[model samples]
Target: MLAHIHIRNFAIIDEVELELEGGLTVLTGETGAGKSILVDALGLALGDRADAAAVRHGQKRAEIALTVDVGALPAVRDWLAEQMIDEGDECLIRRVIGAEGRSRAFINGQPVPLASLRTLGEQLVDIHGQHAHQSLLRGDEQRRLLDHHGGLEALATDTAQAWQQWQADRRTLEEALGSREERDARLELLRYQVEELEALALAEGELETLETEHRRLAHAEKLAAGVQAALAALYEEEFAAQPVVARQLRQLETLAELDPALASVRDLLKDAEIQLGEAADGLRRYADDADIDPQRVQWADRRLGRIRELARKHRVEEQALHAVLPELTAELEALEALDAKLEHLEQAVERSEQAWRALAEQLSQGRQQAAKSLGGEVTALMQALGMAGGRFEVAINALAPGKARASGLDGVEFLVSANPGQPPRALSRVASGGELSRIALAIQVIAADAGSTPCMVFDEVDAGIGGGVAEIVGRKLRELGERCQVLCVTHVPQVASQGHRHLHVSKSGGRQTRTKIQRLDDTGRVEELARMLGGVEITARTRAHAEEMLGQAAQSAALRRT
Candidate 1:
């Protein structure tokens, strides 16, 4: 339920705060007193499209804040929790529109997209605009009302899900059973590619090892020649350096016997000779083992060329080709099993179609049953609303068998006969403006029984209705209020008198011309009602009449409870 609204700098409304109630509440004002501004402010807080022109002249921005109780609304509570904006028992929505046409919205102090606000707003309230009742004329809204009233919403949802799954299965089957030419071409290419990759049979790191060996073999001749030259210069030649170092070491040893210092010198020379001999032996071994095999180099080149050629064919690097091979093999395997996959998809489609048909049939039956009961209820309500003898009907016709749709396979429209002996016709064709308002009100009263909204805003629902008919509409609205909180903007004295609480909007202040609202006391309400009854003046007779209407309304309300 709407707990409060605070609006500032909106149109001519400089600042106005209101505390709303649960039962029937009415807003009545003069023609230019800015009642519509308040309704527009409420709409803004509920995520309606913003307009910069609605901002007060010379003001920088307009702001609206709405507070609502969500303790009894589990869906709204859950949504707030999902958005991480759940307060203990209340949800506060704030909307701000800048003079430059920019706007921002928030829920419970957390910034949110307008769409989130819209989604949550729908659960909390249903605001019907001027002529919004005309939406009843649309077939889609009619079907939704029927389904909701019939308690077939769940089955309708199931049908949509099943139909989607069935369509997905059909698409899968079509792809699997591709054109014959395309399938044959792909199969041949995959088979050959798989065979070629398997034949290569390369190891993980074999390429790097092979490349090193090839480089070594290709330079073997130069390496062998350098090795033999080093050996000859060291020890393999006729007067090798090792023999000279040996003779010097022997002389030093003989001299060392003569003197102690000479002995240290002889040991150093002997260690050098030993190092030289080891170096000579290592060079000789290398010369004997050096190889210059051209044939092996040619073999290495051929192996590398084959690997590169395969890499180019597959559009991958030589190293990455190994990874690609396994993936291709998997694809080829799937192609080979195409027949089995096709069979499975076809069977899945059939199963989903069967499930969808069963749910659709159930939904259709429920709608048919609900249509009859709803038609009867609405027709009776019309008679009570001053359209005596007017009849309402719900016309349900089946769609063609092959036309698959998310909203079951039936077309629903509202039909009516406004007078005695008149043939029933479509609602739009048979009802005039005033009759349409009554008809729409009658349907809404019945639909309200199944509605989940906690608050209902009927903006000018009494339009094109007056006299006793207007009072009856007020009573019907009050009856709806018993189920949910109601907010009505009315110009009818009869409706205004019926409100459990009333607010009078008046424009004052000369230069600024600001709009203000006040909760009416008993005397204040009488004066306002008298103003509505008479034109610009309130006489004694109008005052008496207004007082009598209030007494009658109060008595009527008291009797309704019992």
Candidate 2:
């Protein structure tokens, strides 16, 4: 239940606080007295779009806050928890619009996105605007209204989910089938590419090894000449340096026998001869091992050129050329299995489509059953709301199976005839705005009786209705209040008198006028009603008449319980 509402700096409303109660509460005032401003203000708290013009002339911003008693509302509590807001028995929703058109929303004093506030607001209240009947003309809304009334929302949801699943599966199947030719062409290309990659078959590190070998073989001639020169100097040449040094050593040995100074050099000459012998052996071995094979060098160069050519053909770096082989092999495998994969996807699509149709069939039957009962209830309600001999029907027609729609297989419409002998037609075409408003009221009352929303607000639902019908409308509204708290904005004294509580909206102060809303006591209600009864003047007769109407309204309310 909406427990309270506070408005500050809103258009023509400087500050107004309302302590709301559960019952039929009516707001009555003269024309242009801001009777509907309360409704507009409540809309803001419920996350309605705000504008700078909504703020008062000199105020920085306009603020609207609503306090709802949510002790019995677990959805609201859960939502608060999900939004990370402060939790309690009551939830406060506030919205503020700056003078620059910027806006903000808060729940339990925690700022939140406008969307979060909107989602929670939808659960808390259902406001039936004066033009609600216009929506009744729409088949989609008609179907939704019927579903809600019949408690088939779960079935509707199941149908929708099934349809979406079928759509997704169908998309996959279409893609697989649509690209069959392309896949075949790709299969041929991948096979050829894979075979080429496999034929190259380059081993890891082979390229580096081949390059190193190629460099050494290409320079083998130069390497061999250097080794031969060293060997000749050490041992090969008859006039070689090592031979000459050996001859000198022999001469020194003879001299050393003659001279003692020369004898000391003999040990050094022997050491030099030993070192030269080792050097000559090492050089001779290297010269023998050197590879100057031009044929082998040509083979290495050809192999490296083939690898580079393959790398270029595949658009891969030489080092990464080996990595491409596996990817091509995988693609070839998938192409080989393409036919089987497509067959499997086709079966899945068929299964999902069948599932959606099965659920749609159930929903269609449920709607057919619900339509009958709802139509009867609404038709009965119309008679009580001043449409005597009226007929209301819920028309359900099947659409082609190939036609895809989220709302199941049947198209639902609300048809109405306002008088006897009149053929039933679409509600929008058959009913005036006044008739539409009353029909909307009847539907809401029926929905409320079936245990839907706990709070309903009707702004000027009594438009174009008066006389005994106005009394009936008031009585029905009061009765609806018994099931769900109802807030009505009206100028009808009959409706105003029937409310358990009443509010009077009027301009206060001079020059700079501001809207003032005050909850009326018994005397105040009577006075307000009298003012509604007699314009500009509250005569004694009007007061007496207002009191009489209130008495009769109370009596009528009692009889309804009986």
Candidate 3:
């Protein structure tokens, strides 16, 4: 329920604050009394598009605020909680439009994007009029209304979940199917590469060890020749250096015995002779061990060249060849198993399609049942709204079989005939502006119990209705208010008299023309009703007639309460 509305510098409304109450509230005034301006302000507060021209002449911006009671709407409370906005029993939506066509929106005084505000507004109130009626002309809206009225939300949710699962399965099948030809081509290449890698039989660290052995063997002849020359110099029989060093050491020992002062020199010569003999023996042993084999060296060099060639051909380091082999082997194995996997995927796709069709059939049945019940209820409401000869029908058609789509496979259309003996035509083609409004009202009334919005606003629902029919319309609006708050903009005296609260919209000229709204008391309401009855000429008879209408409305309201 809308608790209050405040408008400032918006069109003809310079500043107006309307405090609202529950049940039906009616706003009434004469022609050019700026009643429409009040509705426009409410629309802006509900996140309607803003225009720079709406700002007052001297003002930099226009502002509209609507405070709505949302305690009963769990969807709205959850949405606010998700946005991290405060969740109170009441929610305030405010819009400020600058002169430059820029606008800002606030929810509960916290700034938010206009889109968020629009989403929340949609969950709070629904404003119905000619424009709203035009929207109802669509087939989808009719289907949605039917679903809402028939209490089929849970079924629809189940269908949606099933459809989503079906789509996911189908997508997986498509991806697997699309790659079949490419995978076959890749399989042929993988098989050949794997066979080639297997034939090489490369071993880890084999390349490094082979290269080291080849380098050592290649220099063996030069190394052995150098060792033999050193051995000859150290151990030749006639010119043996070890014998000469031994003779010098013996002469130094004899001199040391002759004179003690020569003893230190003799000891040093003895050490030199011992070192020389050890060196000669070591050289002889190295010469004997250094044996060169040309054939073995050549074989090792050729093997190393072959390994390097294989490494280059495979585009890898010699040591990395071992790692590449396993990857190639796995690719070949995957290729071998591809056909079996594809067959399995094909079967899965068929299963998915069958599951989807079964669920779709169930959903279609539910919709058919709901459509019949909804059409009957709406038709009954239309008759009560003075369309006694009208016929209402729902037409459901099936779409082509394929991946599951949103709203299932059925395309629904609403058909109606405004008069007896006329063929029912599509609602969009047969319904006039005023007729559409009434039909929308009927649908809304039927679905009121299912709708979550706590407030409903009707802008001139009595546009083409008058007399007893207008009274019936007022009765219906009052009945609707029993379930949710209803704000109606009407000129009919009977409708105005039925309101639990009455607001009078009037314009006054100051520096600029401005609209104002005031909640009228019982006496004030009578004067306003009289004005609506007699226009500018409010006589005693008109006042008395207004009093009679009020009395009747009060009695009707009391009966409804009972």
Best by TM-score: 2
Better of 2 and 3 by TM-score: 2
Per-model C-alpha RMSD: 7.9, 5.5, 5.8
TM-score order of candidates, top first: 2, 3, 1
lDDT of 1 by residue, 122-228 (tens): 77877766676689889998888888678677688898898888788878877776674687788899889888878887778888888888887888877778877
Indicate the worst ten consecutive residues by lDDT in candidate 2.
444-453
Residue 328 lDDT in candidate 2: 87
1 or 2: which has the higher TM-score?
Answer: 2
Q: Any idea how many clashes model 3 has? A: 0
Off by over 4 Å in 3: 49-51, 69-93, 101-104, 112-120, 151-209, 219-299, 310-366, 421-423, 432-434, 492-494, 521-552, 558-562
lDDT of 3 by residue, 96-127 (tens): 99999999999988999888888888777877
Off by over 4 Å in 1: 151-181, 188-330, 337-359
How well does candidate 3 match the true structure in TM-score terms?
0.74
Model 1 scores a TM of 0.73
As a whole number from 0 to 100, the lDDT of residue 215 in candidate 3 is 79
Q: What residue pairs are clashing in model 2?
A: none
